[model samples]
Every structure is written in structure tokens, then in C-alpha cells.
Target: MPEALLLVLMAVLGAAVILVLGLVAFRAAGDRSALAPPMPAAYRDDATGAWRRGTLRFVDDRLALKGSGGLAAGPWMRGNLDLGIARPLAAAEAATLGRSNLIQVPATYGTSTFELALDEQHYTALRAWVEAVPPGWNSQVA
Candidate 1:
């Protein structure tokens, strides 16, 4: 009987700890400070069906992704904005993946393709960036 009682106590303690952690995370996710600035544009997260708005920043000839949610409030993953596109972007293709409208950009600095599900405006911006390659740069698809 005593052992059973101890097991019950342990389980209850574990449940309480989990609840506390969950509440803390929920509160943090609602804190505006958690989101990095500049504002956001809507985009569908291809991996997840959920639509999200992320802050896009162009700096030093590179495009960077900031907050995944609009400059509102949400918990951000570490290094979420560390990577960026540094090389000049070239040709881009507007394609469909399953049901999502995707824009595919041939990676200029990496081997993997860069794909994004962006709204009309954001999609246009991406295409414009690709088209911004200097005339001196050879962007032929050879």
C-alpha cells in the first residue's frame, strides 16, 4: 500500500511540473517581445499546413527571415534567422506542391532548392529579387 501511494505521488508531481512548464511556454508565446521586428508578410509553411506570417529583412545583399509569426507574439526557435541568402538570386519558378502554391528558387549558394509558399505580394518580391541579378552576372540556365 505504501509503495502504491508513493507511485501515485510521483505521478502527481510529474503532472504538476508538466503543467507549470506548459503555462510558462504559453505565456511566453504570447509575449510581443518574443517576435523580432520589421513587420511580416503571410506565407504558408510548406512543411506544415498552418499559415504563418514572417518578418523578411533584406540587408547587406542578403535576405533574412525573422519572426515566423507576424511581428506580434510567438516563441521563436534558436537560429531561426541565422541563415540567409547571400548570393545573387537568378531564375525562379512558380509551382504547386500538393495544394500549396510554391515558388522554387534554384539555390545559388547551396545545393538544396529554396522553396516558399508566399502570398501574391511576397511571391512578386521573391521573383523581383531573382530578377535583380546584375547584367554582368551570367544567369543562363545551362
Candidate 2:
């Protein structure tokens, strides 16, 4: 009985180690220089099809999300913003969603289409930062 219990514990510990390593690798996968500082936002969780709390940061032309929901919150992942051909929905149009702070951003990968909810104060800054990316820089796929 003791041996069986030990085996179960070992299995649980192994799983945790794997998860941590995965998160670390995911977080380190992208270009460090192009990474902008992270800001708090809510991202749609691809795994569970639910909205989860996370940090959103721009990694070059891509947006990466690092979830804070828990171990099961999933890995740090990035999606192409496809800014070359797409822009964030107009603020006025987005405001029609009934949440003034909601911003719908289109992407080509990861969570392809996601909504990010930001406070009124931070909304303007985020939108400006995204729009200011040089148009020429967005021509190439990230």
C-alpha cells in the first residue's frame, strides 16, 4: 500500500515538473528584444473555450498571452495579430458590444479572434501602441 501511494505521488510530481518546464519554454520561445512590457487583460482560453485572465504583450507583430488562472490556465502562447491586413475594430463599433472597455482584436494564429477587456485609462494606450507599429514592418508575416 505504501509503495502504491509513493508511486501515485511520484506521478503527480512528474506531471507538475513537466508543466512548469512547458510554461518556461513557451515564455522563452519568442524574440526577447521585440517583446513589449506585459499588461493585464482577459484572453479567451483556447483549451477550455472560456475567457481567462492573462497578461497580454506584444512580441514583435504578434501578441502573446500568459495566463494567470492556475496551472491549468495553459501555456504562454502567441498569435499573429495579422496587423498587415487587419486593424483593431473601431472603438465606436466595439463599444456597441455593450462593454465600453472591450476591444476585439483579430489574429491569424493562437486564439484567432479574441476580445481583450481593458480599463478605460489603459485602452487608449494599447490601441495607440498597436496602431503605431510601422506599416512597413507589418508586411512580413511574424
Candidate 3:
């Protein structure tokens, strides 16, 4: 019985170590994401026209929306999994909905026009990213 107890203790310790290492690696990967940090926001669904809570991420030159809650609330969790909407920076245009900080992105083919409510700071960051100057400006000059 003592030997069995020792084995279980060892197994638990090994699992804890693995979990810590995995969390560290995941955090490092999340730090590598480009643009702004993940922003907590809700998006209007295309089919149902209902809002779903999620975190918005900009990585690898694309913007992705991942569902919120659960492990995603942790800092180590990048919230990159189960992306709902992933589109290139230039694919969609963002505009203010009204006096509020709400932003509306008109949908393109096969997509629906949706709105994302953001605070002032995040709204500015997202707007700047969407309306940034195009690359290869000098090359365009003949």
C-alpha cells in the first residue's frame, strides 16, 4: 500500500510539472501575436443576428474572434482556439455605429454585417489598424 501511494504521488507531481511547462509555452506563443492584445467584445452573428461574447485577436496579419469564458479568462490562455470569424485586415471596413463606441463592419459576400462595441482606447486601436497606410507606397510611385 505504501508503494502504491508513492507511485500516485509521483504521477501527480509529473502531471503538475507538465501543466506548468505547457502554460509557459502557451503564454510565450500568445506574446508573439501581432497588433493589439486580445480585446473582450461581442460580435453579431450573421445567421441569427444575435451577439456572442468573445475575444478578438490580431495574429499573422489576420483578425480572429474566439469564444469567451472558461480557461480563456486566464492570462496564459491565448484564446486562439475555436475562432468564429477570422479575416484579413483589409477584407473588412470598420465604421462607428453612432454616438456610442459601437463599431460596425459591413459584411462582404457570404458574410453578414455585424457590430462590435468597444471602449474608446480599443476602438481607436482597431480603427487605426484597419485604416493604416498601405504597404509599398514608394513602389507605387513611378
Ranking by lDDT: 2, 3, 1
Cα deviation in Å at residue 109, candidate 3?
7.3
TM-score: model 2 vs. ground truth:
0.42
Q: Which stretches of candidate 2 lie over 4 Å from their true place?
A: 1-35, 45-49, 69-111, 137-142
Candidates in order, TM-scores: namely 0.34, 0.42, 0.52
Question: For model 3, where is the 10-residue window of minimal lDDT?
Answer: 73-82
Residue-level lDDT tens digits of model 1 in 38-124:
333333333334434455544434455554433432222222222233332122322222323443222222332333344445556
lDDT of 3 by residue, 38-67 (tens): 876656645345556667776654556666
Q: Which pairs clash inside model 3? A: none
Superpose all Cα atoms of candidate 3 onto the true structure and report the RMSD in Å to 1 decimal: 9.4
Superposed by TM-score, candidate 2 places the C-alpha of residue 8 at a distance from the truth, in angstroms, of: 25
Task: Output the number of the TM-score-best candidate.
Answer: 3
What is the overall TM-score of model 3 with all chains considered together? 0.52
Q: What lDDT tens digits, residue by residue, belong to model 2 across residues 49-107?
A: 44565666665555556666432322323322332232344566445444444544423
TM-score of 1: 0.34
lDDT of 1 at 50: 42
